[model samples]
Target: MVHKFAIEQGALIEQLPEFIQSHFNMVIDVKADGPCGYHVVAHSLGRGEELEFYSKEYTFSNIHQTLGSIYPTPSEPVGTKHWMSMPSMVEAIANAFESPVFFFSPNLFSIMLPSLLSAQSNSRNIYCISTKYTPFCVLNDEPYEFPAPRYLKNWEKSATKEALGWAQLYSPNFQKAHD
Candidate 1:
């Protein structure tokens, strides 16, 4: 069976694509904390949102790797939380979990954010999530139960390399992490 990557709703809800908005009525909402994205990741992983410092470190490194030319690539401080998000955070979550993430954002499909799916690195592998044309909010189980508003049931399939294949199928730039 095919598994999905579910995001906790805040700003992402408004952005769901036609494919998802028509099929599923579920929408999970993580706490409105600084690390809500992390919360979504943690929830999917069957753990709490509190993670290691490497998560922050990994996120920043990817940002530099991907966008260093366009933005100031200094090692200066960056925040842990997000208003909506900063790029490569998805990549960070993918690395931290050792799982493949899937994006539900329409931006990638529309080319609003072209490199939105790029792994942001051409050198070493970055095991970030994949991109979907439609929208955000999804994942699987040891019978992992999603949070309120949906309480969706899924399995822990996203953690495997197989899930990575699924992500790659939908994600255009997934090769950056592999190739």
Candidate 2:
């Protein structure tokens, strides 16, 4: 029902590429405040027709409990409520696609901003997003605080050129892009 509505509204369709025709994967990640874990949906692209959408939902708390109970010695590391379960969820959905497809997650991207920005140590993605004017210091599920200035300085030194390129797109000069 929701998927149909999304299609009607063009929210999900707008994100899809031309090769994709009809199908798409919808993944839903359950929020920590909710009963379910996050979900990820992937769609498969067909040769001439639209893509086929496959949807999957997974619960982190349930998996964590299962893993903990089965393997008492080696439990998965903890993660933010929403982002922690994302990788596996997305992987499973991708396998179902059977063909390459565009992945769409509007809210998910924003929620994972902190981790995405900080994915690589001393990398540029984080540095680019953590600039003086438009810094990202908040995790969606956690509190937001400004890290020490020294920490930022060290980050700038280690960030990669590629990260810098992306950062420039979001800088003040790219006001049109920002809009």
lDDT per prediction?
0.35, 0.24
When summed lDDT is taken over every stretch of 10 residues in candidate 1, the lowest stretch is 143-152
TM-score of each: 0.36, 0.22
lDDT per residue as tens, model 1, 1-106: 1223354432344464443333333444444334345445555554544445335535565643433232221443234432326334554455554544444444
> Each candidate: RMSD to true structure?
13.7, 15.1
Scored by TM-score, the top model is: 1
Best by lDDT: 1
Clash totals for all candidate models: 16, 24
Candidate 2 RMSD computed on C-alpha atoms after optimal superposition onto the true structure: 15.1
